[model samples]
Every structure is written in structure tokens, then in C-alpha cells.
Target: MERDILHLTVPTFPITLARIAEPSLRERPVAVAPLTSERAVIQCASLEARAEGVCEGVSVY
Candidate 1:
């Protein structure tokens, strides 16, 4: 029934898949950072950045 509404073969996976599952994140430049804390790192990035030779810990600055 729920599958019929979403037209998904496995609709549940998308919800808990990962931040990488966010459609808006696909093929876009993004990263996780800290504001005040001095110890943090990027958790994930989109396919676009990977294509551009970017990845976690590649400082944008």
C-alpha cells in the first residue's frame, strides 16, 4: 500500500539511508563544519565534488 503511493520498490531505505541520500545533496558541493569548536571534520560530500577531485578534509579555504 505505501509502496503504491511512493512508487518505490523499497521506500523505507531512503528515509534512513544517509545524508548522502538527500536528493538535494546529489552533485553539489557541501561539507560539515564547526563554528566555535576547533575540532571537527567534513562528514560527506556530493558526487560533483568527487568528480572535481574533492573529498573529506579538502579545505575549501
Candidate 2:
């Protein structure tokens, strides 16, 4: 018998949810990061944000 493996990703999941909750965020630059830390890292960034040079693992400062 053989088994198959699959991989899936939703890179902008956080931003998607945010936009769903707040329609005004659609088509806007959005990034998700920790709010409590002064040196927070970006966990996810929307396409608009990515185009502006924002990306995951980048500093939010």
C-alpha cells in the first residue's frame, strides 16, 4: 500500500479574517503582529502590504 501527503497554506489567513470582520480593510495594506512587544515580528502580511515591502518574519517596527 502507498500513502500520499498533502500540504496547504493560507498565508493571509489573519488578514483575511480581519477584512471579513471589517470590510474597510479590503484592498488595503495589512499586517499581523504582536501588539504587546515593542519589537514585534510580522506573522503575516496582505498582498497590498507585501507589495509595499512588508512580509512575514519582518520587524513590525
TM-score to true structure, per model: 0.36, 0.79
- lDDT agreement of model 1 with the native: 0.51
| lDDT of all predictions | 0.51, 0.92
lDDT at position 45, candidate 2: 91
Shift in Å, residue 36, candidate 2:
2.8
Over 4 Å off in model 2, which ranges?
1-7
lDDT of 2: 0.92
* Top-scoring candidate (lDDT): 2
* Most TM-score-accurate candidate: 2
Candidate 2 has what TM-score? 0.79
Candidate 2 per-residue C-alpha lDDT over 4-52 given as tens digits, one digit per residue, 9 for 90 to 100? 9999898888899999999999999999999998899999999899999
Clash count per candidate: 0, 0
Residue pairs in candidate 1 whose N, alpha carbon or C atoms collide under 3 angstroms: none
- Name every residue pair that clashes in candidate 2: none
